[model samples]
Target chain A: MKKLLVLSAFAAMLASGTALADTSGKKIAFSNNYAGNSWRQAMLDSYGIVTKKAVEDKIVAAADVFTTADKEVPTQAAQVQNLILQGYDAIVINAASPDALNGAIKQACDAGIVVVSFDGIVTEPCAYRVVVDFKDMGKQEVEQMAKFQPKGGNLLEIRGLAGTSIDDAIHAGILEGVAAHPEFKIVGSVTGDWDQTTAQKAVATILPSLPDVVGIVDQGGDGYGAAQAFAAANKPRPTIIMGNRQDELKWWKEQKEKDGYKTWSASIAPGVSTLAFWVAQQVLDGRKDIPHDLLVPYLAFTQDDFEAALPKIKEGGVATHEYTQEEAIAAIKANIK
Target chain B: MTAIAPGTLPKSSPRGNAARARLLRGLLPALSLALVLIAIAWLNPRAISYFGFNLMLNLAIPIALATIAQMFVIAGNELDLSIGTFVGFVGCVTATWLRDAPLLGIAVLLGSIGAYALLGALIHLRNLPSIVVTLGMSFVWQGLAILILPKPGGKAPDWLLAIMSFKPPYVPFPIMAALIIAAVVHFGLMRTSYGVILRGSGGNAAALRRAGWSLLKTKIVLFALTGLFGVLSGMALIGITTSADANIGNGYTLLSIAGVILGGGEFVGGRVSPIGAVIGALTLALAASPLLTFMHIPPDWQVAANGAILIIVLAARVLISRRER
Candidate 1:
């Protein structure tokens, strides 16, 4: 029975391989807004690796990436228009503004182009969104902290970039978590802008005024900085939530070996750009049943599994998972219901 | 946009040399514009079409407006470091108040312009550096913008949306808007008598004072004009983007300065050309990112390439003006 099931799975794989051939002559473009940080760099790297193989395998004719020099909404909007004019079959975007790019995105939809946005997803109804449950991840951070600290006290919240949807969602989730677990009290909050340096500076500034006794909750790209701030201040260390960055994980490993420090880490994988790329390809391949919004799980690590994943992540890069076409289809299937 | 002698061209000087210098100065801006246009067309012939321009230059309208705003300050031999944030503040207002409450929005916008006039009066009376005053105002405007809209979501007014997306038959909206802006500003600040007074204040304030022109009024008017155009720029930006972010217009500060310089406007002496400034704004709008896109430059090098393009064009302008000297 096992042999028969394996033979049938092989046949199903063969069938999907033939189905992928329909998009062999089409081209897709990735329109990225910014690449100033490690997360975005890893995103582009994963996209390059995945799309290079896709092109080599003739899954698509070409997959090119275009990143705007400035992190301005209008610049990225103009880029989408250019991609439309260039006649790409589809465009995958990590947008600058969720709604500011809607004009350009609507123009793309009017021109009959498929647009799939991830990470910094757009609100345009015509576009496909591949989102990770950031709120859940935020809630999970506190839950994990509960497991380690057992007795929660004051918490320092390091927020992401100001005026971003992801930042708001994660903040809301953390607030909800604290409400449910009344022991965790958020004493102070600082805007980190999702950068290590910025987070360090912000935490350093607020540390002098706050009573942070137990743990630190933060949006990704900021954990290491908070730890650094705590170290520089010569304060007792807290159970800080990590953001799946290599440096954060590396620091966690060091602390774990020294004193058995426990924590949790989670972030939307940067390689989600590749998943967005695959979604665009699927849409271009005449898949009408795909939902407009596909929610995938965030990349996360705990004390037991984080060390194993740390070495695989590039130096100064975030932990990431490049999505294959099968995994993308599975994600789509899961979202369908 | 024709080459017009900017201001009192030294009536007693070597007349031929003065005329030649003025002509070269006027032509330098157009030359830079033409070089960028030709480079774009050469890189990708497809970008020369009407649709191509509409898409490529979609954001140029606001940029040109912002440049014109900067030109007014430069014309008075002063600078506005706050215009960018001011525009962002205006954009936040347009996206929220302008859409929800029209009368309040209009009042607030006009009030802000009045505030600018007041700033001008204060700067003139106190003998404060325009640079320092405007620099401080930049933070004030940014804070106000964030207060109005903490997040990056607001709808552009329907009328604004309709006006911005309007497609004229032969010419693109951005091009049409640029021409109108250039023509109207050129007439107002170049041919009119009061415009001469304004420029004269920058050229020779003592002579203007002796001539019985109120330098205070000119400064106020210049600043109010900057406020007016900045509001328009912010509104146009939101109309195009269909939403607002508090940081949306932050880039305009440097870009506006660059546009004014690229358009052959001088830092002091009221040596500014409205038509040339408009052309310069267009040149920058095109060169900022479109040229790099057409050139297929790598993303990693695009910012550096943008700087190189700016340097090359400005260098050519300097070289041309030098030849006339």
Candidate 2:
């Protein structure tokens, strides 16, 4: 009886291997670090929508999503190892830290799985990254500010979370952009923590002390709050270079209609996850020309663009530009060197 | 015969100098709060205004509530490491189910409090360390919070928001809320008849047991009170933020513990102050960010500076307390 049970177990393993080889469709999984924010929720939503369509179109066999709350690297590393053992064709990740997941990512690569990291990306050479050039986003924001204030004045730079790589990159890019215009003096800066309530309080506290600020440059997610702070303080509204959240866009649209306000906004859309999904799909479909690092562009909004996007936004929903599969493919094709 | 000797005071009279020292020690928390307030006002004159007080103390209500909750657990000689995450869990429930299905939400919250009571009973019966149990329960609460909300986008109830945003003519909302919390908690935990028995259980468990009071009952009551205040703290937090997240209340644990200690709460003694706890919470809220911001400290050093301020004030408290002994 023992010999028969061992022979049956071996036979079952062989049968499962044959079944896996026979399936034509590819299985993909998303290894998400933190699902505690609206941005992450939106990303997961887009993934759900796109993956559903992919499954219906017979482009993918199955898609699975796993999220960890603590944003700890070990939890995500263990998750990746589990995904590897489950025989996933590809894994897309929003890593907690850049270097902590390298070992697990290397293991996945050795298992012949395609790995795509986006948003908070991993730095492992084996992993393909899909992200916006945050530094350039910062530079473009300052340039847009320059358009509003041609003769530069005091620019209140509201930063994101302190000590974060994205914060450092964006601030560095803003300084680089301001280097050309010596008159654009940064009067004061505060970390808004990339949250609305925190930003509003920080701005409210600092507004009384700052000199007549002519413009504002903020890392996205705090523009609406900053505007509210200025209004609450009864100060004349400065040209707040907006981020692409729905609330900010709605406020911007209202200001344009009521006061003829003119300011540009730009953001990396949460739908970028869909792009990462398509890139993973492309790689799985034997696309060899994909680059290791793909820089997705931010959706830059002028007054007209905001006007167009305003009608599409639902109540309490974020304003996000959809990244189509064709555009994802074209971006991949364009960036190959 | 010794009474005939005049012009000399009794050196062993415990009521003379030690009484004054004890009074000073009792006033330490309030003194620290006043110093912080004065420093803030001197640095930024605008901080003295009614609007400034409202803004600076906007988030104090939740901290005060959480400190009161921690005080309950400390009253029973137990530390609740899970109170922070428990508040987060309650916040998530308030944002989602409490808004959608009011009855179900109420049931779930009551069930959680009951779970706390059961944990107390288990700790008493099994002779388990409360720190270990509560620390383990913290992850459980965190997981349950995530399961309920999944993300950070739930609107607080309109009524709660209204109450939190209430601006009286003379006093700010936070100050009013703090007064009410202090009064209610002080009455329930310090002045009531059964309160003495509950405190005695922590101060001297063996004696209380010998005196016909059940230790298990006191532990359950104390833990239940903690659950009750933790729920209030979470609801208050959501009311201020206008949204909910699983990790929003993560910082409350240490803040609550610090507030209790700053308010003259000891770990093993049933000595805690409801009024001083609120004041300590207010001091921490002010010193957490606004003080550093007013001082023009860089954001990178603000956390460290906040710790330094806490250490300084707490050291002063220690010195005064030592002198009293």
Candidate 1 docking class: medium
- Model 1, A1-337: lDDT tens per residue? 9999999999897577547579999999889888888999999999999999999999999898888878887778878887887778999999988878898999899989999999888999999999999898888888888888788788999999877899988998998889889998999999999898999999999998987569999999999999999999999999999999999999999999998998899999999999999999988888788899899999988789999999999999999999998898888889988
Q: Summarize candidate 1's per-residue lDDT along B1-325 as a digit string, tens digits.
A: 1244869454655667767787888888887778888988888788788888888787888988999999998989999999989999999999999999999999999999999999999999999999999999999999999999988889999999999999999998888999999999999999999999988878888888998889999999999999999999999999988889888888889888888887888888898888888888788878877776667676677767878887887787777666665
Q: Write the per-residue lDDT of candidate 2 for residues B1-325, one digit (tens) a residue.
A: 1243555655766657788887887788898899999987888776677766776676678889999999988988989999989998998899888888889989998999999899989989998999999999999999999889764557677888788878999998888889999999889878998999988888889888999999999999999999989999988877766667677677788889999988878788788888889998888777654565556443234446767887887788888878777
lDDT of 2 at A204: 94
TM-score of predicted structure 1: 0.93
- Interface RMSD (Å), each candidate? 1.5, 18.2
Superposed on all Cα atoms, model 2 deviates from the true structure by an RMSD in Å of: 23.8
Which clashing pairs does model 2 show? none
RMSD of 1: 4.0
Q: TM-score for chain A of every candidate model?
A: 0.94, 0.90
Can you list each candidate's DockQ?
0.54, 0.02
**Candidate 2 Cα outliers beyond 4 Å, as residue runs:** A1-337, B1-15
Model 1 has a DockQ score of 0.54
* Winner by lDDT: 1
